[model samples]
Target: MNSRFDPSPAAVPPRGQLLLVSICLALYLLFCLQQIVLPFRFFGMTLSLGSVTMLGCMLAISAGSLVRHGVPSELVRPLLAILMCIAALSASVLASNHIGLACAFAVRYATSLLALWAMLSLAAACPRWPRAATLAALIAVWFNLALAGAVWFQWPGALRVALAFHPEETFKYLPRISGMYEHPALLATSAAMVLLLVLRLQQRGEVGRISLALALVGAVLALALTQVRNTLLPVGVLMAWWAWPRSCTSNRQRHIARVALGGIAVLAVFVLWLRYPDMTSAAQENMMTAFTLGRTYLWSGALDAWREHPWFGLGAGVFQFMVPDYTGGRFHRGELHAHNLLLAALSETGLFGLLAGLALIFALWRPLLRIAAERQWAIAWLILVLGLSTFDFYFPFFPFSMHAALAVASLHAGHCAPSQADGVSRSTT
Candidate 1:
C-alpha cells in the first residue's frame, strides 16, 4: 500500500473526510485548552460554543455517512444503540428528582454517543482518515508535552499564559502539571491514549517509526509528571505488554516470563517497603486517606440507591443529589463522578445500565482478540485505561470516551483489513 503521505489525487480524501479529521483535531484542542469557545443561554438551558461545534460536526458526519454509505456497519449501530439506551434510561429514571441535572447528564451522554458514532463513521467511511486522525493525535501529544514540560519546570512565559487561561484549575496540582487540562489525570489520560495511538500508527507504517518512538518516550514522561496513580496503571501495562514479547520466546514462555517479571516487581517493592518501613507506612497511610476521600460512605450510599432503584438507577446524574443524604453532606463538595465507572453506572442507571456498560466494553475489546497479539496491544491499552477507570473515572467525559472509542474503532477497522501492510504488521508477526 502507498504511504499515507504519498496518496494519489483520486485517493485524496473527500471534504467530509477532511471534516472528520478536523473534528478529531478540534477535540484534542478543546480538551487541552480548557476554555469553552463561547457560552450562552437558550430557553433557560445553558450551552457553549464548544458543545455546538462538537454536536454540529458529529451530526454532519453522521448524516453524510448515512447518505454516502447507507447506514454504518452493523457494529456501529449496536454500540450507538447501547449508548442511547443507557443515556435515555438514566435520564428518564432521574427526571423527577431534578430535570435540569438529568438533562445535563443526558446531553453529556448524547454528546459522547455522537462522538463515538462520528469517529466510527469517519474511520469506516474514509480509510485514509485514520492515518490523519492518528497524526492529529500525535501533534496534540507533542504540543501538550511541550506545554506540560514548560509548566513542570515553571517556565515564566508558559506559566503566565497557562495560568491566565484557567488560573483556578490548570496546574492546581502544582509541582505537578495538567498541561492545559483541568487536572493532571485528564492530561495523563489524553497523553496515554495518544501514546497508544502513535504506537499503533507506527506499527501500521502510517507514521515514521523514529519520530513516534521519541513521542512515546515524551508522552510517558509527561504522564509520569502528572503524578496520577490510576492513569499510570494503563501506561505501565502498555509498556510492559509492549516489552514482554521482545524479551521472550514462545507464548507459554512469554506468559511465564510475564508472571516472573510481575513477581520480581512485587518483590522489589516489598524489599523497598522493608528497607524504608516508616516511609512505607506513612505513604500507605496517606494513600489510604486520599483514596478513601469518603468513598466508603459514598459507595455505601450508592448501594442504598441501587437497592431502592433495583431495576433502573436513581436516574443518570442523580448521584450528586443523593450524595448529600448519603454522607450527611460531608463529601458533596467535589465532582460527583463516583471515581468508579461501575459504581457510577449502578447508582445512576442500575443493573441495566451496568450491563450496557459491560456490553460496550465487550464491543471495544472483543474484536481485538481475534487479531494478532501485537495488534492486540492497542485494545490492551484501552482495557487497562478502562480498568484504571475502576479506580478513577475519565472515560465518561466526552473527549476522553470519544478518543477511547476511536481507538477501539480504529482497531476494528484495522482488523477488517488485515492484509494491508503497515509498520506494526511488518514489525509484528
Candidate 2:
C-alpha cells in the first residue's frame, strides 16, 4: 500500500515534526517533575525552570499557529467559552471576603485557562501530536515507578536528594510515596490517566505488546501504592468499560453481559452491606478518618459555604480560610481548597460560574463527539476526567486537566483531518 493512503503510516507523523513535538513534550514532562527532580528556579523568581519552559513552549506554539493559520476557526467557540468561564469566575471575586487573595487566585485561574486553550489549539493543528503525548505519558509512568523504587530500596543518595526538595509535611509523617507529585492522590490520578492512554495506544497499534504490559503493570502498582480509593474506583470502572465489549463475541452479547455483570456487582454489594451493617459502617468511618476525616469534612465545609452564599457563594480561595467557620469549627486547617470539582465551582463561583463551566464543557463536547466514531478512547478519557473530578479537582486548571485537553484535541483534530496527519502541508506548522 502507498504510504500516503495507509492510515497507520500517515498517523506516525514526519520525523522532523515528531522531534520538535517530542522536545516540547520533554519540557512539559520536566514541569511535571520539577517538584522532586529538577527544582531549578528561574532567576530569583518563584517560577521554576520547568514552568518557564512550559510558558515558552505555549507562547511559541501560539505564535507559530498565528503566523501559519491565523487563529483556527475550530477554536473560536472554545475560546469564547473559556472567556465566559473566566469572566464568570472572576466576577465572584467581588463578593469575596478576602479580595486580595481571591483576585490572586482568579488571575491564576485565568492564566491556566488561557494556557489550556493554547494547548488545545496546538493539538488541533497537529493531528499526530497525540502519538507523542502518549509516549510522554508512558515515560512519566516509568519515571514515577523509578522514584518509588528509589524510596523503597532506600537508595541513600537519590532518596535523600529528592526528599530534600520535597515539602516537609508531605513525607514527614505519612510514608506514602508520591513520586514526582506533591501528593499521592495526584500521582495516582496521573498514573490512572496514563494507564488508559497506554491501553488505547496499544489498541491502535501505536504501542508494542511489551511496552503496553510494562506500562499497565507500573500504573497499577502506582495506584495500589497510593491507596487513593477515589482514583482506584474510577479506574476500575473504566477498565471494565474498556474490556467488556472485547470479551463478548457480538454487540448483543456484549450488552447482555454488561447488564448482567453490573446487576450482579450491585446485588453483591447490597448483600454484603445488609449482612454486615456494622462492619460496613465501621469501614466507612475508618475511610473517612484515614486522613483527618478525609474529604468528608472538606466537602461538608464546601456545602455549608455554598448554602450561605448560594447565588455567588464564597469567593475563590475563600474556602480555605473559612473552612473552620463553615465546618462548625471542626476543620482548622489553613489553605484547604474544595477537594471536589463541582463543589469548588459552586462554592467559589456560584451558579453563574457553574453555568459558564458547563458551557465550556459543552463547547469541547462537540469535537469530542465528532471523533468518537474513530477514537472511542477519547470518550473513555472524558469519563475518567468527570469521574475523578467528582472526588478531586480535575477541571479547568489542574496540570492533568490541561494534559487531558491536549489529548482530546489531538484525537479530535486527527480524526477531522486525516489527510494532514503525515505533515503533507505547511499549514500543519
Candidate 3:
C-alpha cells in the first residue's frame, strides 16, 4: 500500500542535522564501492580512502555523541578500553614478530573494533536514522546485485577484473561471479547482509510487501551466482526460523526446542559424514564445503597458537605468522586469516579478547531479543552476522564489517525507545 520510506530526517532536521545526514550517506556510498581500493598516504602511513572516511566518521560521531548525549551508559566504552589495553599488552608481550609489526597489528585491531562501536553510538545519538541506515544497506545490495547479474550473463572480462583483488584469477570460473568484493564468498556474504537489512526494514514497515518480495528474489539470485555455500546455510535457517509457527508455545519452551534442534542438526550431519566418507573427498575438492577443505590445519594451528599463549594468545593479526609453524606450509600459505571468527579471536587475542567479544555481543543481545520477540524477521539479520563470521572472517574486512555494524546499529535502535537503545534512563541532550 504505502511506501515505508521515512522523510522525517529531511523534513524535520535543521541545516546542521541535514549536513550530518548527507555526510553519513556519502560515506556509506563510498563504503559500498566494495571493489575500489583507492589508497593514499595519510601521515606517512598508507590507508584506503574508504577506511579513512569510515574511521573519521566514527571518531566524529562518537565525539559528538559524547558532547550532546553525554557518555553512553552501554558497555561500549569500557569494553573498547579493555580491548585496546589487551591489544597493547599482547603486542608488547606476546607478539611473534618485530615491535613495529605488533604495533601495527594492535592499531588495526583497535580501529576495526572501534568502528563497530562507533556505529552503535551513532545510532544511539540519532535514534531516528534507522531508515537512513536501511536505505544505505539497500544501496549496497543493489550495487552488488547489478554487478553480479552482469558477470553471470557473460559480461566482458575487463569489467569483472576491475572488481577483484587478483585480476588474473577473476575469470577462472565461467559463471561464478565475485561481484565487487575480493572473493565470491565475500560477495555472497555482503549480499546476504543486505538482504537481512531489507528484511529488517520490512519488519519496521519501512519497506513495502511487493518491494520486499522482489528484493528477496534478487538477493537469492545474486547469492546463487556467487556459488558460496556459507552464506546459504544461515539464510536458509533464517527463513525457516522466520516462518516457523509459534502458536501455543511458551518462550522458555521455544528456547529449549531451538537448542535441541541445533544439537540434532549437528548430530545428523556427523552421522551423514560417517555413513559417506567419500563426501569428505568431494568436500575437499570444492571450496564451498563448510567443514572440509583443509580447514582442520587452520584450526589446528589456531589451537596451537592459543595453547602457546593462553591468556592473550598470539597478538592481534598474528595468525598468519604462527599458523605457518603448525601447517607446515600446506594450507596456511597465502591465507591471511583464521577463516573463522572465534578461532581468529582465540588465536589473535586469546581468551581475553574472546571474553571481550562475548561481552560486546551480550551488550547487543538484549535489544536483539526484544526486537525478535516482537518481530521474527528481525532475528535474521543478527543470524546473518553470526553465520558469515562463523564460516568466514569478515571482521578485518572494513567494508563488509562496517556495513554489518550499520545493520546492527539500526536493529539495536529500531524497535526500542530512544532511551532504551542507549541504555540510559533519560536523554541528556
Candidate 4:
C-alpha cells in the first residue's frame, strides 16, 4: 500500500491530483463551517451554501465516476446497505403522522448516503485524499476554536457576527459558546474527532511533534469552553487510554485492568442512580438531572412513544413534533429532537428502521475493521463520535453525518488500491 507519508517520488500525487484534492479539501472546510455561513430555506429545510457546494461537488464526482468507470465492486455491499436503510426510513415516513417532516428527513438521509458514495469515489480517484482531509479537518477545528475564543473574550464585533449566523433562537439565552455550530456539543464533538485525527497523523509521522502538542492544548481549551459533559467524558477516557504507558505492563494485564475499571465504573453509576435522591438537596439539582439536562424525562417520553408504535415507529421525523404530546408539553419548543440517536431512531423508525441501521453497520464492518488496523485512532475517533450521539443528535443531523462519512471513506481509501484490491478487478475512479 502507498502511504501518504511515503518519501518515494512515486508516492507523491501529481500536480493535477494535488489541485483537485486541494479544491475538495477547501469545500470540505466550508462544510465544516456551515453553521456560520449564510443559509437559505429550500422546501422548508434550511440549506447552507457550504452544503450546496459540497453537494454539487459530490454530484460531479458521482457523474465522473459513472462516465469513467462503473461502481466499484468493493462498494456493492455498502451501497446496498445504504439503499436498504433508505427504504426502511421511507417506510417509516409512510407511517408518520407528519408526512412533510418525515419526507424532509428521508431526503436528508438520502443526501447523506450520496455524500458517502461521493467521498468513496473521490478517495478512489485521489490516493492523497485522506492526508488532505486530515489537514483540512485540523485547520477547520483550530479555526473554530479560535472563533470560540474570540466569542469568549468579547472580541469586537464577534458577538454580532456569531448572532447573525446563529440558527437557534435559544442560543441567545444560553451562556455557552457554540462558535460556528448550532450547539456547543456539536463543536465539542467535532473538536474531539479532529484532535484524534491529529493524534493519528502524528503517530504515523505525518505531523510534527510541535503540531501535536499545540493540537492537544487547543483541544483541551475548546473542550473546557464548550462544557459539554457527554463529549468531555469520552474525550477524557480516550486521552487516558492513549496516555497510559504500555511498555511497563503486559497486554493481558492491561486488558484485565481495563475490565476491572469498567466494572467499577458501572457499579458506581448504578449506586449513584439508586441513591440520587438522597445525594441531592433538590430533584432539579440532582447530578443525573443536571448531567442529562433533564433528558431523562424526554427519554421516558420517547420510550412511551416507542411503546405505542413498536414496529414501524412514529415515522422518520415525527418524534420532535410528538414530544409535546408524549411529554405533556414539558419539552415543547426548540427541543428539535429526542436528543439521543438511538432513542430518536426507535421513536421515529422503530424496530424496522433500527434493524436497517444495524445492517448498514454490518455491511461496513470490513471497511471499519480495515480502518482499525491501519489507523487505530480513526476508530477511536468514530467511537467518540458515537458516544457523543448518545447525548445528542449526530447521525440524523446534516453536516455532522457527512463529516463521519468523509472520515470513513478517507480511511477506507487509504488502505485499499483504486483497482485490484478488495475484489476490484477494474479501476474504480
The TM-score values for the models, in the order shown, are 0.76, 0.77, 0.74, 0.79
Instruction: Evaluate model 3: give its TM-score.
Output: 0.74
lDDT of 1 by residue, 228-323 (tens): 556655555654664476532457646644764464355435434433544455456475544444466677777877777766777767677678
Q: Score each candidate by Cα lDDT.
A: 0.62, 0.64, 0.61, 0.67
What TM-score does prediction 2 earn? 0.77
lDDT of 2 by residue, 17-112 (tens): 578647756765655544443344322224444445555666776677655555455566677788888788778888877777677667557656
lDDT of 2: 0.64
Candidate 2 or 3, higher TM-score?
A: 2
Q: After superposition, how far is residue 51 of candidate 4 from its true place, in Å?
A: 3.2
Q: What is the total number of backbone clashes in candidate 2?
A: 0
**Judged by lDDT relative to the true structure, which candidate is superior, 1 or 4?**
4
- lDDT (10s digit) by residue, model 3, range 300-328: 78888888877776677767765678777
Query: Candidate 4: which stretches are off by over 4 Å?
Result: 1-25, 32-43, 163-165, 168-170, 239-287, 370-372, 375-382, 421-429
Ranking by lDDT: 4, 2, 1, 3
Worst 10 residues of 4 by lDDT: 1-10
Regions of candidate 3 where Cα sits further than 4 Å from its true position? 1-25, 32-45, 74-99, 149-174, 248-291, 370-382, 414-429
Among all candidates shown, the one with the greatest TM-score: 4
Q: How accurate is candidate 1 locally (lDDT)?
A: 0.62
- After superposing candidate 1, which stretches have Cα over 4 Å from the reference? 1-27, 30-34, 37-39, 42-46, 76-80, 83-96, 149-167, 238-287, 290-294, 371-375, 414-429
